[model samples]
Target: MPAITVDDVLVLPRLPRLDPAATAYRPVRRLITAPSGYEGEGFPVRRAFAGVPMPELDPFIHLDQMGEVDYAPGEPKGTSWHPHRGFETVTYIIDGIFDHQDSNGGGGTITNGDTQWMTAGSGLLHIEAPPEHLVMSGGLFHGLQLWVNLPRVAKMSAPRYQDIRGKESALLTTPDGGALLRIIAGEIAGHRGPGSTHTPITITHVTVQPGAEVDLPWRADFNALVYVLGGKGTVGTERRPVHTGQLAVHGPGDALRFAADERQDSHTPQLDLYIMGGRPIREPLAHYGPFVMNTRDELIKAFEDYEAGRLGTVPAARVPHSHGQQPPR
Candidate 1:
């Protein structure tokens, strides 16, 4: 654990310049617009892809873009006690403080740029909300949460949590210094993220300057997609334009190419992107609300155990910080 510095971001490896003519994959499939919805105690959210079920995004079930809204004093709200099984919940905080407490005695505060990777294997009860102080004097609340499915064999394992600091993530700038990528759970330009995963996944927070270019490579077998956080950009060779609050579902490709358009508003001279991909689980999912299992019978058993007090309760006490074990490099 040497000290991480800004120089670390500036001197990272550059993306490979693959031959455009020899490229094997670059197909923009469909675009998904996440409709607005409310979750928990009326917390605003936008449900991205997999709100229904697209097996192509297997190993990855759901994506929710939480508030980028300015919360008035006492207006902040969040999820109450809930149980999850058969998969992991990945929370990446962007603009506010999110507090968490779980039955396994796992809890922490996720502030700007921090990430909380929780494996809700077996079963566990947890609650997430704005920190009490923030709830009292409300500010901005914004982040993204993704559900990563586990294999049937690993679904019933004991639960665990990973609290990774913002600085722990690999922050990289493009060779021309026009694009920036914060790698939270995957590799980009030879820089690896801090968060560990049971499945093969890559989650990068990208920001590109107007007219700038950023290229990212991924395994051909992995399902790659991008969620536009702000501004606008063109993706892949198709040059399909995607704007804020839209999900670009990309087809099988060896790499991802994105650029912010120069002919955009001066108020928005940059584009923010959340690019993700992973090895598909390729298994049938019996999903119901918060529980995802291989069979309906197992799904029923989950509810039975939860109702029988098998899954623990949210703590009365606040555990401000519960650091998790680092995955081996």
Candidate 2:
């Protein structure tokens, strides 16, 4: 909720209104409520992309809404060392702190609306956890982790990392100054975010005030999706009702329409949304656990590589705790 914001939205650049007669607004194709689940040492999460067909979620495989949880002392949890290949992991923190370390010497502490992007293009070992002090004191934690797939041509690219601070996002407002848009990656209205991507995509976080609506221009060729992070709202021109933990997939169009309800719960003063879309890869996908590939043989090779320690060794510092903790296939 404390992600980048402004004292007065009217001061920011506003989205230009589009012609109603010419603008083709995307229609809501499906609405799904995410199922609750657990991940990485028992941290609570919501499976944001569950029950959706792969073609509809092209270039994106998994998404987890991590904790709106307030942990008691000693209750904090995190992932043990693990391996991933052929994809990217994007962790965005809205209200908490997280420390991350990968075998590639990419590790840091990010908190209060920061993001840690890890691209396990070929393969790598990584660990994510709370700092020791936070584990002892406990506090609020809320965030999201999204898995983005690389095209076949880039599947074997070298792993990389990008640390994006919340302030680096491009901030904009709706025409009436009733909503805020934070562009995290890709471009919107020609204003691009700080993230660099191998694929063409756009990821934005939207916060709408009560009774506010926004008609956003989108790429006609890219897929469109919106997921509710919290609060209540309606998506698309049909105004299909949506609330927290819901995801809406939209049909082809040149724009999207959504608005927050006039009344919101006390706990949620605004309608928070995570919107993303990308050009579909459309390539054959063979996936198993953390490895995503184009063929079953490629998947088998991935597993074999990991077991054979060709996926990179766990850092010497973590050998003590990461040994024998290989994630089950």
Candidate 3:
């Protein structure tokens, strides 16, 4: 990995740039806004992709909602115990408090500016909820849930967890005074994040100021995408506008240049974007609901083992709804 320095920050390369124009920005194919009891009124959760619907985005599957909510104090609504196999789930919290407990006897709380990484290698059971005080006091709650697929060789590896505090992650402030880049997995500018991952991937959270521009390098062989969390900005040479809750899919390109229009006063002279890419796995992906495996027979066996009580070994905790939830057809 080559490191680039800008203003005392170090950024490293995980992959070369692929063509960004190969694929245009596609609107979120599917969206799910599920209400969470923990967050006040309407807590919209949008499901970008999941399971068999979109097998793998080069080792990635789902990019759920970019949530922004206000939780009334003391509310207890949060995600309950669930099972996952052969993949990883990443929770990035932008604001508020997120507390979690897993069957591995691991439990902890993550406040604003924190990230939780969980690898459900073979299988694991877990539950996530907001903190009681924040939920009742009415505070902003925002975050994202991303699902990354594991290679067949690593699918059955032991489950694990990584909790990264926001202030501890790598940060790179662009020279043009327009972008604040957070290196979550790979490297950006001249900064590298602290989280260890299983694939060759780069995940960045970027904020571009109005009329500011920054060039991002990526590998040509890796697949990539840019997700707009808030505001509007232009990617590459496309002079189009992108708003919140929308994702822009870029083909293989060497470098990504982002620019926000300088004339719009109503538009917050800033753009929030999540830039992610990874080496695509050229393997067959067989998926059903929450479990992603290599074959349908494996999926069937997974179900049988769960029913027979053998698949619950990793997370020792049993979810009440596990038996009743059927595999997706």
Candidate 4:
């Protein structure tokens, strides 16, 4: 069979009309400042909620802020072959390009604003690396990869992949056109995201124009948090100010209000925020590097499966595709 391209798996969610009567929800949870770490051969990464064992943050296991770093020519870095099981990987590229290939005959290039959702159900071996051109002439690399866990019943399901084009995302502008919200996995302003998820989750990328404010609503059952990608801003009813590289873990509330620093600064552009949450699975978690299962026995079985080559293999038809081909806007 020919390799399955991203276009084949891309699915758009039906956009919904906004409910004008929707009540406002403010963030009230504890704040968590993600710590910096390294992954994929010294590539810098910020470990968010998953690094810490917070039962409040379930289903959503780990979130990594990948390189916002500028690299010189020949300094490009990335992850080689690795294995994963029992979770879904959501990779969102903000600046540069990422080339990925997996054991299930899934491979593709994701550039600025694109997202790749890979479900490592049962097991899978994958490689996430930079394209050769980028390695030859480096530039700024910025993106985020989040790991979403599967329920016990779905843990051993067949692996699947979906590459969502940025343009397919539902974009909504504030009434005054001062801010924009990019919905990737949930409804915002009644516009739905592009992802088909086993777990109920919401991932929204917000751009707050200088001196402008925006409000977003999330389900009361979903545990929510906001991660600052750039500039500084106040989040929640308390207006707790959070800056770049900081994560604001919201308390129970139905809606979140984000206001960029009111004092406009041409040098600062605007505030970049990523708000994500989902209904907690509330199950026992046995996690090891690259594996997350309900029990240690299950995790052991996963490793055994991968070792025995139970996970399917990438088809021999792995032809390389050019990168930087942004989806049609």
Candidate 5:
């Protein structure tokens, strides 16, 4: 999970040390473990937001943690061309390579710590797969793909894309330097990430050293969630035990808190977390498959559009995809 690292976290901006007495830390409202599944041409994925309520996940709809698996030669898999409407897909590569291209002309190869931000406003067709060389000589592949819902007004807006590199992320540290924070999007205590989002949100990846704790000030208006990528830890003010593939939903508060256990398996020496929060859109949501709209009719229209070739068609010049797969009917 070497998406980004610092030789000395002390050199980064330190999070404001809040007075514990005054800080209203969020309480863990729910904790759920992600179930493993296969996605897109047989690549493994963990559904990170499984069992979470949609209202609580407003502004953000879905999440998938892609393989932390080592692929043998010719074993890398990827999604075939597909269509999505009324949302954006944020693909962050933590330790592998992924190539993406959409009909709206947004995409490229993103490697360790790189992020592919694709807005499917209105609608578009896209494909994601490993590069040809990677497919030939497979190696480690791990990453996350988060679905961010667009507001009704922006749902039909023009599509766009942003290729964000890992080095472009804003780095911060806990007051005690026990943790490293990589802010991928949104504002955190006057610091902002590079991702230009239609909705206000914050996405961060935190690495906590063993026996260390962290307190992150959060927007009171935003809903919070913490997901463990690897290792063991306790979350929230209640110190609820959490482990790999677990997600913790937090109640309203002005800050977030979690800690790493003193001992962890050698395979995972540090506690890794992907934390995200966003101002709730709180709109009527109608979602089915790749479409996220505000009404059932709209979702039906999205499917109709795709079938009618309104969403988009696969580019003739696109590089080869996994096994020459086609869009699912």
Candidate 6:
């Protein structure tokens, strides 16, 4: 038999409900966004990737919000000329469009409800800009970009891309009304996601209606987090109130249980969230600006290579600002 890839052994852990009080819940850290303070015509809006300061959330580095922009006609705001290493970026767009170009010779536009997965292996360069149509219309542009660290063995692997369409991804509807689970890279309720991944991880976009409760089983060996995009709910028995832009980290356990309030009927409070967790690398992380490497020597070499003009692969120039101008919150 041929050697097995990490994907071969990856199986979605069984979903089980844990007692929040009994299991011991860890405090979820809140990451505050700071201005990118970039000084270039192409810098677009103040951008910040959430991974740097929140390094305690190991294995996962950053989570960035692009926008909820309302653009005017013929206006474009976005970013240009960035490099990355030793990590993977997963961009999920809820509204508007994004033109993406990269040093791996990959370039394209991802519209509303699209997901783009880019792995910056040994090294990669890319740019993301918004489109003119949405900008001119002043439409709502909202999206998220998450960074997953690469294990040392795969740090120098070749870069790759997987563009997953909204329709192609798997969706699971709970028996209870108004609850939906969108599985992007992992499994939920026995159904698996469609995208390919380099690591053993689970990514799900979950929505819970008022009075509905859902329980998910996960791995005890992996680090887990729940990011509340909107609405409110309690994880396990903690009954903690979660709001938009807040992240909650759960303790290592076999499952996660979420319960919605049962009393409110007129307004079914919605819970829009992403449940993500993965095996921790536990290795030294050396990150500077946009690049992440396993050692100081490797990081220094990356800079030398880029300055020497040896990292020359470039994606085709794309339409500027197809996605929007707002940076990651």
Candidate with maximal TM-score: 5
User: lDDT for each of the candidates?
Assistant: 0.79, 0.89, 0.65, 0.77, 0.92, 0.66
lDDT of 6 at 258: 70
- Compose the digit string of candidate 1's lDDT tens values, residues 105-135: 8878888888888999999987787877887
lDDT of 2 by residue, 1-329 (tens): 88888899999888889999999999999999999988877789999999999999998888899988999998887888888899898899988788898888887888877889998989998888888888889999999999898999999999999999999999999989999999999988888888888899999999999999999999998999899999999999999999999999999999999999999999888999999999999999998998988999999999999889988887876522223344522
Candidate 4 lDDT, tens digit per residue, 1-329?
00111232224332233353665565556677788888875679988774455586777888888878889998877775678889999999988888988988886999888999999888888778888899889998899998899998888889899999888877766656666677889766467889999988899888777787766667888888788887877888678888777888777766777799976455446788888889999989998888899999888887788678776565565434333322110
TM-score of 4: 0.87
Model 1 misplaced regions, further than 4 Å? 1-12, 50-53, 263-269, 318-329
lDDT of 3 at 89: 81
lDDT of 5 by residue, 222-286 (tens): 99999999999999888999999999999999999999999999988999999999999999999
Q: Model 3, range 1-329, lDDT digits (tens) per residue?
A: 00112353324222323345663332222222232222112355655443223433667787765466565555424655567788888888776767876766655788766778988888766667666565557676678788888889998898889988777667666554566677888765445787788887788787766787766766666666777666766666554566666666665555666666565345344577777778887678887867888889878877776667655644554322212322321
Q: Who wins the lDDT comparison? A: 5
Which residue runs of candidate 2 sit more than 4 Å off their true CA positions?
318-329
Local error of candidate 3 at residue 189 (angstroms)? 5.1
Per-model TM-score versus the true fold: 0.91, 0.96, 0.79, 0.87, 0.98, 0.79
Error of 2 at 247 (Å): 0.2
Candidate 6 lDDT by residue in tens digits, 142-250: 6778888988999888988888887666766554434566678866556778778777788888767676777666667667778765566666545666655556677
How well does candidate 3 match the true structure in TM-score terms? Answer: 0.79
